[model samples]
Target chain A: MTTGNPGPTSGPVRSEFADDAEMTELVQMFVDELPERISQLNEAWNSADCQRLEHIAHQLKGASAGYGFSVVGEAAAQLEESVRQAEDNLSAATRQFDELVDLCRRATM
Target chain B: MQQQEQQPVLLLIDDSPSIHRLLGFKLKNEGLDFLAAFSGDEGLELAKSNQPSLILLDLNMPIMDGFETLHALKDDPETIEIPVIVLSGTTKPEEKVKAFELGAMDFVCKPFDIHELRVRINSAIRISRLMRMLELRAQIDGLTGLWNRAHFNERMGTELEAAQRGESEIALALCDLDKFKNLNDTFGHPAGDAVLQGFAAVLNAELRSYDIACRYGGEEFAIILPDTNLEQARSVCERVRVKISERVWPNYPKLSATASFGLTHIGADGRTDASAFVDAADTALYAAKEGGRNQVKVYSELPEAGDGPAKLALAS
Candidate 1:
């Protein structure tokens, strides 16, 4: 059922979406820092530094969505929201963090 | 350095009008023609069309940002080799790291430091120019500004390789000055130097425009004649030999120098090694030396040329 809905699956659908060029730039920037960000995020998550993770995730949230990686942005937003609550559900948070990493890897690689 | 005749094209991709104006003025003296693009899309388009040697990409933009622009620039085959320097306002620690990963060769922060930015651009241009110059120098002989021995070897190899694969006639000749050392021994080294320069000039003048003459070493030269057989090479070498023999040494009465040449033509089953071709010419050179020191010899029959007493002349 291809609904002809242009989205991430279509791989950068440049619409009256004046955002394509902007998204391209953001994606390029994100991919450029991806390895470093991935490493930093992994470390922060592992060390249970929720505040730092929240800060990183907050930035990623805005940036990922800007580049049309909505799912990644959404996941980053969730992770940050959970971190803000100081929730002790480490396992659940870790799962979301891992998914975020996967989303980032997919967006880039 | 004084400005060169041709100004290399430099692509400046920045959305800031002020920055553009300032840089346009700043780099006016650099002798580079600037192609400006305010947005990534525009810049990429320009890059595709112009193929600028260097790109100045701004990181922050509205619809398309610098990072995305960088990725697109790196991905495309035509623009891949073109170096990019990120000129962005994003000063975050993570941002700098990302810029490098995304194939930004260098980065400049805005409110750009004029000196730092100029230095980076200058360095990029310098390095690129140096690389091109080194490549050219590698192909040339340092002393005479002619092709070097390695170039000669490579070219000869290619010619022979082509000949071996097809029905092409390739003629190779080696010419050595006869009794050149005696000139150096009689006159000072300066006189010997004069002779070498004079010899090269005369050789350059005598050979056909298509033929290549390279100084092999002290008092020795090599000429490669394509689509020429051993007989043609022999004749060509004879003309050059006669011209050189008749040349009166400057300030030295009764002093004339001659060159002994060995010519060989490669046909079917032609050998490709530099050593083999050289050896054939060398054998002919020895024959020239033996048959009274001022003629061309072709390597037709090995046994009949007969062993003549080999007189070794030191290279001048």
Candidate 2:
């Protein structure tokens, strides 16, 4: 299971570790879950609800990092940041949120 | 739903899109199908329906993490035989230890190589197949595909014990081919093989599946009739003897043969020894051969030949 270069928005979360071929293919199974999770995160952001957004972001962060998509995890972290600081810079937070979602999509791909 | 009707399923629970995509692509060609669940609840539901052969679970998730899922899986009898492998981003020693303690067969850290993952999955499947095969081999005879001597011993003991306990009677019959050696010598090795095969088919068709027929040796056969007495045993032996005597060798049409049978019954006294039952039957068999090549002899009225030991003998 060769994990190629991480996209610009995502860092190499999975590349640091070396696993046998069996483990590698197992990691590759994550491809199926990405789209639905990304949609859920998007829904969480659309509502501008900090709690649900943070919940979704945290999930993506933990899972994407495990699957070697540090970029997606980083994007999730930023999205979580916007939710945590929701009381300030509402518009700016929304823009940052959009960028984070895009980052997640690119990172996973 | 019928328990017997359930189809075995394999569940793949992971949160990464790329992982699922690649796996679906790789596994699609292998003739196995899998259901994918990104969350624990979804995985649990799929497991309930699919009853998978194995589970590949991811540790990190939004709600109901892999830890909880593994517990639920192991705790459920329906899913217990389904082996699980943890696919997680947590490379921590404690995490791996915890996964195994929770009954995961293996743990693989994230960004796994496809080749290695395939090998592990295949290995797990192979192990399960081997275990099932071993269970089957225990009941099957290796040589003639008929029940073996050991099976006969077990069935006889059980039947006799059951009969003794219930105040019932049981019958035993032993059949030895008459002049079998001469047939082997005249027909050569291949002809001898054909005889055995042909005899087995005839015996199989003549007897019910519940009737135990064992290849006692080179050309001998044994049958144990539960709930049967000496009269019934003689009747069954006659039917079988008639079938065997009537068979015409396809290649050598003129060739004809017969088998001598020994019949004995365990009386209501329930004191008949297991070995004695066989001994009585064998003695009757010798009588059948001595009296006539094609005949069924009962042990109660017959005298035992001075056949050395009291044990059942294979008269060479």
Candidate 3:
């Protein structure tokens, strides 16, 4: 599924806002929202909620890099692409989805 | 003019919490109020209400996506002027085109550079503010800095409709500078223009911010006072007249000019036509002039006017 690299899943994702106090609040918000979003991501994938999966993946891909989660953005981009195209490769979709979620779980501030 | 002082508000419409967080922080230094909406529906709702200066929209949202939201915003008269910048993660050129075609002002890629985004926002806000300033200039009187006659007419229609809906009282006053022709002939056209400008300043000073003042014609003006009764409007017009009479013209120090006002209220009866309402005010103004100049009279007070000329003079 992944061509060797599964993307970063440890340590802090560096962003320009890393030094900002206001950004710390946003980091807190992201942390607070993590469990719920991760659960929804899992539920959507398991039930073949294709639209939900695509939406989550799209949001993750679009926002993760901005939040300094480059690895999560990379994985989510792959998942979003696969989900949107209705990719026949179920294993690849599963791999990318898992990787994206995994990186999100591992994300620090 | 007061609206000029507010920081331009930026609405961030993105389903992604991270995007909201990032954009909020990234653009925080730009002196803009940031409004966040997680869904396209919420975004549109906020856009319609707050009418933010600029919107940073994410292209791939749920239910109503970025394109749909952009279309909705562009379609509405209230929100149409608000500029929108699309956020796209995929770097898809076609999607970017669609966003542009649908009325997006610009785009921010997934891995956005904060400095670049700041520059884009600043540029967009600068352009928007410039455009807004031009639009407002078109509506303002060149000499007085008040709403011009055309803009006043346009605003009166809407205000009348609103007054009717709310069943609230709205007063219209038609004011004319007494013996303006004599003053002009005595002093000259430039002095006449100076008096007009000075009288406008008095009106501006005496009137509330929400009150609409306009130069209806040469040496004549109009005022629209929403949520004001006849007595209140009369007092205001009287104050303006007194202020004008008391003011010493810088160019013509000894020259003192007076203004006559015709006041009328759109009461609970719902007389909603702007033409008739204005005409009624004009008629009352004519009565003020005939009742010996420099007096404020309500249209309803005209019938009993001649009976109490002494009282009117004393009041004046």
CA lDDT of every candidate: 0.72, 0.72, 0.81
Interface RMSD of 1: 12.3
lDDT of 2 by residue, A30-101 (tens): 644556766887776666566777766756665555455666666676676677787544565676677656
Per-residue lDDT of B173-275 in model 3, one digit per residue for the tens?
9999999999989999989999989988898799988899999888889999998877788889989988988999877887999999998776644554777
Q: Which pairs clash (backbone N, Cα, C closer than 3 Å) in model 3?
A: none
Say which docking band candidate 2 falls in: incorrect
Error of 3 at A30 (Å): 7.7
Interface RMSD of each: 12.3, 5.9, 1.6
The local lDDT score (0 to 100) that residue B75 gets in candidate 3 is: 97
The TM-scores that each candidate's chain B achieves against the reference are 0.66, 0.62, 0.84
**A28-74: candidate 3 lDDT, tens digit per residue:** 67766777879999999888888888888777777666665666777
DockQ of each: 0.03, 0.14, 0.56
By summed lDDT, the worst window of 10 consecutive residues in model 3 chain B runs over B307-316
The alpha-carbon lDDT assigned to residue B31 of candidate 2 equals: 52
Q: Score every model by TM-score.
A: 0.54, 0.55, 0.77
Candidate of highest DockQ: 3
Error of 1 at B75 (Å): 12
